[model samples]
Target: MKTILFLLRKEFLQIFRNRVIVAMIFVMPIIQLLILANAANYEVRNLKLQVIDQDHSSWSRQLVGHFTASPYFNLTGMVASAKKGITAIEADEADLVLHIPSGFERALRREGTASVHLNINAINGVKAGLASSYAQTIILDLHQEIMPVVELPAGLSSTFRYWYNPDMDYYTFMVPGILVLLVTLVGMFLSGLNIVKEKEIGTIEQINVSPIRKHQFIIGKLLPFWIIAQVELALGLTVGWLVFDIPIVGSLGVVFAFSSIYLLVVLGIGLLVSTFTDTQQQAMFISWFFLVIFILMSGLFTPIESMPGWAQQITRLNPVTYFVDVVRLVLLKGSSWWDIRSQWIALSIFAVVINGAAVLNYRKTD
Candidate 1:
């Protein structure tokens, strides 16, 4: 017990003694949250909206004016032909195009229907979705006001209320996800390379020749990094709250429980990487490469639904996806254990699979 505690203490001090590293552990995630929050917004603010007004009437002008007035869009171009509007939207000069047909006002007056063709790039699906909906709402509002002489039932008019983060601030959504990245990164890199350092220094052979069982030795070695990563998790989250005003809307105990289990798999993965690598540099590079791909594709910066079907299917096999999703659920959505049962189950399965692989690969013999 004393030896275990002493080793843990030594490891903790080694990690925290470096000022640059300590700051990076706490600061990088916050920086990423800020950058991603800015870039990850689904709202198309300052949207370059091009217009093709064929009607040349008050109603058509007013329609274009409505889009210009709305904060969600900016009128960047006014084209005489629909082809020019298409070129604008296609050439990256505009994000969306609004075309009022030649008979727009006339059709509305006589036929009760007028066509407005809105062409949008759905590559970034969320922004496209929001842009379309905002345009639709403006058009619908104008329609209701102009033609109030006729009325429809309740279904045609609906109001949406965002349950949490009503402002749709991406920072609030990204803080927790970045927290997962920070913790996972610290645990994997430190634990993966620490053993390599020991081996490089000829200390690993000294310990192996002793009576220490592989499991006990491995667990003792990992315990410090594991605890330190958890501490970093707490500190990172606290900073996120104070700096970014992110809220913890769910149980801390639940978050910790899930995090603890998830860390097992992460640590196991690190140890597994260390087992295959010859040096600390190799371990670090491999672990970092693995982490980058896993985090990027894990729905941390974007929604899983927005990914291609094959990409989404591939992400399902990545454990970080579950970790990020569960943490976000707890933080943003106040999801309880029952609400997160599927995540818990998937993480449990992941833990079993990874730990099993690590144990199989971990050997005392050369």
Candidate 2:
């Protein structure tokens, strides 16, 4: 215990002794948080809308007015024909085109129905889907206002209520996920890089020559980083709350508890990487490859349910997946500890196996 304490003291000294690393530890993440929280938005706003009105009727004009007044769309241009609207879409000038055929009002009044063609640039499927939905809602609202007695088919009209984040603010959803990522970056990269940096500076050889046990050395290295990562998490959460008005709906203690366990999994992986690699560059590239895969598969931006079945199966092996999911569930939805029992069990097993492998693989003699 005394030996571990001494080593911990040494590691902390080494970390604080480097001014550049200290700055990077705090400054870089803050910058990334501020930028990414705003930039990584999924909501489709300010969509470019074009209208081709062949019929200069009041009904057609009213429908176009509904779209223009909508906050989701920006009416860019009004063309005379469908061909011109199609040309605008091809030129990347329009995201959606509303085409009203000639005698549209006449057909609606006489036949009680008229078809309007909607052409959307499906380059990005999410954006197209959202734009289509927004446009359809406006059209429906207009139809109800203009034609009162004309009732649509049953089961077609339904209302939805957004829970937790009713405003659908992207920042609220993204901040917690980004906080998880920041903690991960600090824990995995710094811990792996620290060991490799010691190798580069010939300090590791001196430490290996000493009468320190492997467990003592590993504990010493991981403890300081573990503490640092927790501090980083706290700082990030504070910034998110104060700056972005993000609330901690669930138990903050639960959040810290989960993070503490998750840190061991990542730190152990870092140590495992350090055990095999001789140089910092090799460690960096190897860690980077895995981190990228972990982030992409972690469902940070996309829904896990939307992914292919095989791909979703692969995410079960990723520790980040569990952290990202649990953080969002607990923070946003106020999920209880019992609700995350499966994640806790999976992470615990992951920690034991990963750290145990790292310890077994570590060689003091080599």
lDDT of the structure predicted as candidate 1: 0.82
Kindly list the per-residue Cα lDDT of model 1 for residues 1-366, writing each as its tens digit. Answer: 665666667677877797876776667756765676566655568878999888998889888888889998988878889788878877988889998999888787776777799999778887898889999988887787667543333345576898777877777887788878878887888788888888788888887788767777777778877787788788877877888898889887788889888888889889989888879989989898988889889998778998999999989888899989888888888989889888888888887888788777777778
Local error of candidate 2 at residue 329 (angstroms) = 0.7
lDDT for 193 (candidate 2): 90
What tens-digit string does per-residue lDDT give for candidate 2 at 264-361?
Answer: 99999899999899899999999999999999999998888999999999999999999999888888899888999899899999999999999999
Clashing residue pairs in candidate 1, if any?
A: none
Whole-model lDDT, model 2: 0.90
Give Cα distance to truth, residue 66, candidate 2, Å.
1.5
Q: What is the lDDT of residue 351 in candidate 2?
A: 93
